[model samples]
Target: MISAHLPALQVVIPLLAAPACVVVRQSTLTWLLALLVSWISFAIALTLLVQTFFNGPMSYELGGWAAPLGIEYAVDVVNAFVLVIVSGVSSVVLISAKESIERETHIKRTHLVYTGWLLCLTGLLGITITGDVFNVFVFLEIASLSSYLLVSLGPDRRALTAAFQYLVMGTIGATFILIGVGLLYMMTGTLNMADLAQRIPGVAQTTTVRAGFAFLVLGISLKAAVFPLHYWLPNAYTFAPSAVTAFMAGSATKVSIYLLLRFFFDIFSETFSLRTMRLDLILLILGVIAIFSMSLVAIYQSNVKRMLAYSSVAQVGYMVIGISLATTTGLTAGIVHLFNHALMKCALFLALGCIVFRLNSVDLKDLAGVGRRMPWTMAAFVIGGLSLIGVPATVGFISKWYLVLAALERDWWWLAFMVVASSLLAVIYIWRVVETAYFKTGPVANTEEAPLILLVPTWVLIVANIYFGVSAVDTISFATRAADQLLSTF
Candidate 1:
């Protein structure tokens, strides 16, 4: 009976921990509990993923009622893979949260901060595990509400404005999704995703279904910060506390991308989405623009955090490109980048967190000579940058290789070239940070390195980057399985 509830436990463990953190009210205790909860969630994700591989899809009915009536939690390779990444990254980032929280958040609000963190974690996991379409919207809002509070908790006043902007955009996005879900319910009479999929084909050509699809795509695009709709991301990431930035950077929009894949491939028939709607072409055009424009924007950013934020938008572009191809190879690339980019961006942001620990600023000029003072941290940043540049034997190279191969498989040579060319932009921006940290001398003569706690977790992600880059068989295997599961739904 206990074993039957893994999906429920995956989300409930974190959900329950949120209140415990508040009740404890001691920062240290709260941090420990949060860390433990995150790791437990990660363990659950691993278990669920293994179960899926061995047992096919596993479904857990809420209140012991079957689907289309009672809610269900479904696990397949697709979401199980994402569950692992989200929970894994959250656990790693929480390891360093104590120091980062102390440095960047207010002392009086520490308890509330941990509470919000756990709530955000709960929401994200819930979103990934839920099998009901309406439940997706509910969990998405839970994550969104907690995230706004998390962003606003930063010591910087700009964090307030950033949170507000994110709130406005996020609210609009949620509203659109809700409306779309309502429309679908009106037409299909069921909210369970599997049930809905079984029903959608009967009315796929109806105006209501088409409108629902449109709203869902636009709403999800806004949340995912797809190009031309990404105005809220840079400020939000730049102004949030470093730890907050790291967790969100590593997982948030990636989850949104997962939703896109889920909806496009699973809920909606591929014939309707790719053939009739022609979303493939739309995503392709936007993906290309995002890759070039966001990368170029990243190159000119003065703040290192802001530059990385823009880089994230560009990285999303790469994922969108994979989605546009609508082939197994393309989807595999998208799914792999979802994991790989999380590794690189989290490593980069955590490195920035280390720098912020000592220097209190991540502006390009402020980073001058930081390499000498904080060699380990700067070196981590450098390695992460190389991965961002798609150098051979790094996770980025593996991801971009798949992307290029997917493009060429479609005979889109220009797209193949664009994939390679975008990495050049990554190089320029990464070099800016590297040059400032290594070549120029700081005005201050003496400085200390980041604490071991922060340094250790940062290096963990760094090592993962190199390790996964060099030995990608396992990761690629997972991606291929997830891709097959997605495409098979069609």
Candidate 2:
């Protein structure tokens, strides 16, 4: 029975756990439930990925009703990859969050926090697993709503303001996506992404199709915090609880990028949007601007979390640049970076979570010279930072290598140079914190490191950064295959 309904179980396990969380209503109980659900999602994601890789894409109609008429849960290499990212990262972050949450969050709200975490996990996984466009919007909202709540959970009152700011921007982005989805449905009379892909091209020349494509891309850009649209990110990350910030810094925008890739490569005809409308050039130019501009901003930030937040904007440019190249190699580079950057950033943020848990601050001044006292934690941070700088033997290096290779593949020499230059900017920004943590002296001298509860997860991701960096074949292969799947449509 479970075998037959694995697709349903993939999403249902976390979905059902949300209510079970409310029923438990005790902080420790809720924490255990949340951890169980995340682990369940992680197992199911792995099972689904295995099933898809071995068996090809899998689809199950709700109530056994076939689509384009019925709702469907689906899995493909692209989304299977994403499901693994979301669930796998959430599990690691949860172990660390257990300690961070207790210190930073109110005891009374701990149960609510766990509930939101489970729902957010479910919503994010649902977005990746669903086959229908309307369903994407629904799950996007579910995740966004939970995200707002989580961001506001910090002890700082500024977290409330940040959450509100994020909510306002998120709502606008979601509305735009909904309208785009509605436009596609109105034109094609179908909501299934696969079916819409089949139908939209029949009417691809219409102005409405063009408009829908524009709205959809723009909406995704906003949700993904692409470049100029990233105003809400820094504060939101800076003020959010360590656990929430760590999880989101790694997962949220990455999910939005998945949606953007799906719509651009699958649901819409690239000939119309990229060729006729010239979105490729526009995206390329904006991507370059984002890479440099945000990296420069990152260098001067006083707070470590906010700096990383800006670095995320810069990373978005790399993914966009890969896509704008409009080649299999280019898309493969972008997709692989999506996976690589998630691991690297999650590790970095988890390291920061340790710092925040111990020292109660992510400020550069606060991190001063504790490097010796918190050697393991700071060592993990430095390694994660090196990964961010694309150092020789880390995940970051592999991602930038692919991005550079993609640029050269397009004969875009200037783009290739820009990629290198962006790496230089990354070096400058990552160096700031390194300087503060290791070079400068602290005010008092005896500040200790965060406990094993947090360090364990941080180190897990830190080691993962190096492991995936060294063993790049699997990520490269899956990304290439997924890119081929996407480029075939173009």
Candidate 3:
């Protein structure tokens, strides 16, 4: 019977725990509560994903209300996969958060930090699980607001500026999504995504509907940090507390990409989004631009975190490229990369968190001799970096191989070439850190490795990167099934 309420409990547990964190107002206790909530959420998500895999889509109505009149939580292969990613990342990140949070923020503000973390997690899970478009907007705000709070808690004074910038841009994005949702409601008279999907084709030709589509896509693009709209990301990641960066890097944009897939492939027909709206070409052009430009930008960043931040934008481009191809193989590549990139980026950031834990800085200059000084931490960084470069036997390679296969399937040799070229650019940025940490020699402040607490979780993701890469059959299968389900709307 309790299993029947898994859908509600998935979000409710964290949502309720967030306030309890503030009420407890004790750092250690708040962290324990968050950790427990995150692990439970992960368990629920994994269960839901497994159930959806075997049973197909599952839907739950809130308060026994049914159909288009009430809020619904829907699970399919696509969102269930995302739920696992978000909650799983939160669980790992929180395991290491206690050490990182205390070092980077005021000790007294620790409860607030944990509260924000839970709220952010709750928001991302809510967005993924909810079937109502309105609820998506609401959850997006919760995540955005909490992210701003977490970012502002960074030790640097510039963190306030970063948080304010994020707040402004995030607010603008939320407004766009709200307006788009209102337009859809006006046309369909329903907020439920399943109901709207059934009605959208009737008004798909209207100017209002077209405008709404544009607004919605634009809004999500901003949130996902798609190149031109990504001005806030580098600074936010550069200055935010380490654990916050790690969690958000892994989850937030991935959820935005999930929304894009949901809207394009589920709510709007593939024919409409790809053919009528020409979204495929639009995303292709932007994706190509983002990959080349952002990777080049990343190579120049002095801050290691900022470098990875720009790389994150480039990685988004790869996902966009896969989505733009609008074929099953293409969507599979995009979806798989969504999962793969999360693993690598989170690992990379966590490794950096370890360096930050000891050195109090992520500047390249500060990282000199870190490879020798903190061998385990830098080792984790190296593996994560190699994954970022898409080297064979790493998860990044798995993602790119699928993407290249998708490109070749379309006879898009040029696109495939660009993918390889962009990956090489990643090598340059990643190698910059490697060269600095390993090759460059200098007096360093810390010679000891990060504590086992941080190193364990960092390597957990690092090992996952290699494990999933070598044994990619299951991941590929899951992504393929998710892609097929999405393209079924065509």
Could you say which candidate leads in lDDT? 3
Off by over 4 Å in 2: none
Candidate 1 clash figure, as a count: 0
TM-score of 1: 0.99
Expressed as tens digits, the lDDT of each residue in 1-490 for candidate 2 is 6866887887788889888888888888888888988998899888888788878888889887898888998788899999999999999999878789889877576788888998898888888889999999999999999999999998689999999999999999999999998888889999998899999889888888888888888888898999788889988988899899889977899999999888888877666667887989998999999999999999999988999999988999899988888888888889999988999889888888888887888888888897877899889988998998899789998988988898898788999888988889888878888888888888738677779989999999998999999999988888888898887773
TM-scores for candidates 1 onward, in order: 0.99, 0.98, 0.99
Error of 3 at 404 (Å): 0.2
lDDT of 2 at 222: 90
Regions more than 4 Å wrong, model 1 = none
Query: Across residues 279-382, which tens digit of lDDT does each residue of candidate 3 receive?
Result: 89989999999999999999999999999999999999999999999899999999999999999999999999999999889999888888988999999999
Better of 1 and 2 by lDDT: 1
lDDT of 1 by residue, 222-308 (tens): 899998889899999999999999999888898899999999999997768877999999989999999999999999999999999
In model 2, the Cα lDDT at residue 452 comes to 94
> How many residue pairs clash in all the candidates, one count each?
0, 0, 0
